[model samples]
Target: MESQSSLQRLLSGPIAPGELAWIGLRPARRASMIPVSAAKLAPGEGLEGDHYISSRNGPRQVTLIAAEDLAAIGQFLAGAGAQPEQLRRNLVTRGVNLLALKDRRFSIGPVILEGAGECAPCGRMEETLGPGGYNAVRGHGGILARVIEGGEVRLGDPIERIEEDISTVLARRRNR
Candidate 1:
């Protein structure tokens, strides 16, 4: 079995304009595209929603704030921690396959999500980059998920995988 340290990370783009490239410790499926009525989206408040739309036939795309990175950033800002620079993922996903999360089902806290599609970067990234943000995540798929269950998600929370190997399950279902 691969150690947790061996888990690959996916870097789609930067967090904000003028910010460094953002890396997802584990990229996940973009669920329903529904809007999560969590706390207000602030600069440092974590979660933020943009006007960009991924699927017209699907739900709205809601950007998730990685609780892990937020906690680390918050701690450093509070002067109670010492850590190196870290990549801030918009969505903190677990369990569900980071690469095959789309069109699938997963959960956070107690909420079950209906993975819709990919969260690709847009031209607005260029505005944030002031020059080359558009090219940052050209082919990379950033995560976009609709909140199935609304609950406070903090760092260290587990993104339990309902299916151990999605491909295997899917193949079996198809054969049936």
Candidate 2:
């Protein structure tokens, strides 16, 4: 077994920021997502122009997938190719472990987002990726989040972790 200090050391390190690689918005349910270079996010709403805008006040206002996961999913599907739009996520990022952001706050460009939970693969994934699509995205579905501060998010924006006390963060989230 590893020592406590070793475990701490393993977890403690500079955050590896991610870059926004793609943005997509579904204007209507069961519709394909339209690619965009930039988009505006609103608190209590999702990405502007997205179908979920009117009903996305909950914790899952936005969805994100890592670029690496997309690649892995593609490989898992035997080079079937997993595109961001097909995944139906609002943002596709590179170089960040989105799962690590759960219950934490992060910033993308001028927007601040609070991680809500893991974005589990939906049944629709089968229709999107075909045959094994659902299974391929199971553990790689990325994360769900809500906008804490509204602002514009553009492609290539950096996704960074925000350092804050847990209690204070919780208190702030509760007030929102």
Candidate 3:
């Protein structure tokens, strides 16, 4: 069996972004999942905002942020003895490094998310997590994906690989 940490979901956001923001359960009583897409990190954007990962033909937009920045946040919070779980990232996947998934494809249930590009950190990190967070995930290849099919994704969902070998994809990028 795979380790518990190996399979998990990951959704997160700055405590506050431009126009103010917060990562919380979106309003849609029956909808457990939201479409994920790729987009530039504007001055203020997050998981629950209007641009929190959307779709071109449907109700979805890109949800993104720097992965390395997240690690930085985790590290700082860890150093200060701040409970990392308190940060409230929906899924904390391990082993299947996120940066490697850039410009690739991964399946989340029936939905296929094409890794479009990186989601860089913005000034919001400095505003929310602290000044240091802005430097945390600068170019770590944060994930930007668009959902090809809609599905239900809740907290603790496992990030499973169904088609392409993401390890190779991620490895190739790492070698670059």
Candidate 4:
């Protein structure tokens, strides 16, 4: 059996906060994304002006990619750097391990987001990233999330993991 400290180390530790490096919104299906400095997120609506807002699915309200992963993808493709627009994700973050936030609620500026799952690479990756684009983005595809509390998220906002219990955070927000 693991000791208390060891268990704690495995379960909880100092959070490495990340930064919101970029934001993009697709205004229409199959359209190129437009970079934005800030955007409003809403429950069940995704980003206010994003094409995904109308998506019937709830778990895919937002998509995020780590800048580090993008760099890795670029290196994997022989210096072919992949841009945020090419990935088709809504947000690009740096320094945080997105997979670590699985099943957890986190704060990105004023917005509260619940991690849903991995945003697997789709067929479009090849068309966007070139020959091995699909394979390049295979494991670096980032994460999907649901908006828990809608609010404005701006470029350069700190992406932080919520240390408090999600229930406690939600309760406090409700009481406010």
lDDT, each prediction: 0.38, 0.89, 0.41, 0.90
| Candidate 1 worst ten-residue window by lDDT | 12-21
List, residue by residue over 3-67, the lDDT tens digit for candidate 4: 67876576567669998999999999899999999999997668999988887557899999999
Please estimate how well model 1 matches the true structure, expressed as its whole-model Cα lDDT.
Answer: 0.38
Please name the candidate that would achieve the greatest TM-score relative to the true structure. Answer: 4
Q: Which candidate, 1 or 4, would have the higher TM-score against the true structure?
A: 4
Rank order (by TM-score, best first): 4, 2, 3, 1
Steric clash pairs (candidate 1): 17-128, 27-98, 30-144, 31-145, 33-60, 64-90
Superior by lDDT: candidate 2 or candidate 4: 4
Q: Could you give candidate 3's per-residue lDDT for residues 2-98 as a string of tens digits?
A: 6344233332211111111112333343233332332122122223433243314321234433333456556754553212222322223333556
List, in order, the clash count of every candidate structure.
6, 0, 17, 0
* Tens-digit lDDT string for candidate 2 (1-176): 95578766655445799999999999999888899999999987879999998975898899999999999999999998999988899999999999878777898987889999999998998888999999999899999999987889999999988877645765775688
Model 1, range 4-122, lDDT digits (tens) per residue? 44233332211121111121221223322332323222222223343232222233333433333334433434533211112223454322334355554554433344455665556
Q: Which candidate tops lDDT? A: 4
TM-score of each: 0.42, 0.86, 0.49, 0.90
Off by over 4 Å in 4: 1-11, 171-176
Tell me the spans in candidate 1 whose CA falls farther than 4 Å from its real position.
1-58, 64-90, 93-97, 164-176
* Candidate with the larger lDDT of 3 and 4: 4
- Shift of residue 102 alpha carbon in model 1, Å: 1.1
